[model samples]
Target: ILDYFELTKVDKEGKMLNIYLQEKNIAPDGHQHQDLESKGFFPEVEIQDFPIRGQKVALCIKRRRWTIKKTGEIISRDWGLIRKGARMTTEFGLFLKGIFG
Candidate 1:
């Protein structure tokens, strides 16, 4: 799932490290087709990640959208990288659980 994101930029603001990523061109239906056209990007979502050098790290991910030329259906890949009901990566959530639970 992490491989879906391509590292684009990185920023450091005080005690926070922000990592910007762009989602790779992945077929929503799990099969590549010629009818898919680049539509745009979804709203940026921030998900907390493991701290680095005592600085809070967050991943700003931008998921891509596509439009099917034949049907004009908007499609986007639903990558379940974040934990349920939490603005954090699944791996980070599991790490916290291991420490606190």
Candidate 2:
């Protein structure tokens, strides 16, 4: 997909692209910690495609964020770009299944 993205426009390294992923996490609502619950929120995936463009390089995922909420617990899951440039593609759908399962 990077190759495809490159076709349209070069995404230089360190150029931050903000991605919003619907994450289920327990965020303090400032109400109470006594009764904690899992709430869905859009967690940002902040990362840069590395190596910098104009230098002719592959799309390198520099950084990303992922979180899972389990009331008194949090877990980090694996993330990968199943598709690039295109939003919510079939590959992205499969990636969700992999994450959920």
Candidate 3:
């Protein structure tokens, strides 16, 4: 799933719920992204009840962004799809790949 695409793992800075990449590098993550993506979701799942505590996708920028860490290929641009419930590392890394690639 997510691992199949190769995503970076990143964390949000400070107490805020926003996350971003440092130097636009591919974000990193520890989950079996491959397993999740294999569920056939990838960047196409309806997210509600975000899995993270006190974290929510409230901004447009927080909704779209994801890529393949290996090739730096963009998978989606929906922030709501990238934040919280899903791993931010792969999303951020792919975003970095988008601009840098």
Candidate 4:
């Protein structure tokens, strides 16, 4: 999940009773990417009962922005499917797909 990728600064928002979130960094180091094959972590994710919508509350990660923590460098990457499910989302997937996708 995002925590595994060291994603931080989690923020939540609600518009029309829908749920949304924002985060940054693929990892705590902010300069490395994890190997999904070995880590077995998904890139995108969806969350249910986010605001306790009685089975209607949901949140999905559609994109991400990757940058160096110190230098503010934007790393170039390829396009790929983001992990689905808020509990399953990872920072790596967001960083790549956010820019390329």
Q: How many backbone clashes does candidate 1 have?
A: 0
Candidates in order have lDDT scores of 0.89, 0.37, 0.37, 0.42
Error of 3 at 40 (Å): 23
Candidate 1 TM-score over all chains jointly? 0.91
* Per-residue lDDT of candidate 1, residues 1-101 (tens digit): 55677999999999999999998887776648547988889999999999999999999999999988988888898777999999999999999999999
Q: Tell me the TM-score of each prediction against the true structure.
A: 0.91, 0.21, 0.21, 0.27
Lowest lDDT 10-residue stretch of candidate 2: 59-68
lDDT of 4: 0.42
Q: Show the lowest summed lDDT stretch of 10 residues, model 1.
A: 26-35
> Per-residue CA lDDT of candidate 3, range 19-85, in tens?
3221122233543262222112233332232235766532112223445556555553223344544
Residue pairs that clash (backbone atoms under 3 angstroms), model 2? 13-52
Q: Which candidate number maximizes lDDT?
A: 1
Q: How many pairs of residues collide in each model?
A: 0, 1, 25, 11
Q: Positional deviation of 35 in candidate 4, in angstroms?
A: 20
The C-alpha stretches of model 1 lying farther than 4 A from their native spots are none
- Model 2, 1-101: lDDT tens digits are 43222222334445443332343332333423444444333343333322233342343322222233334553233345535554344454566669898
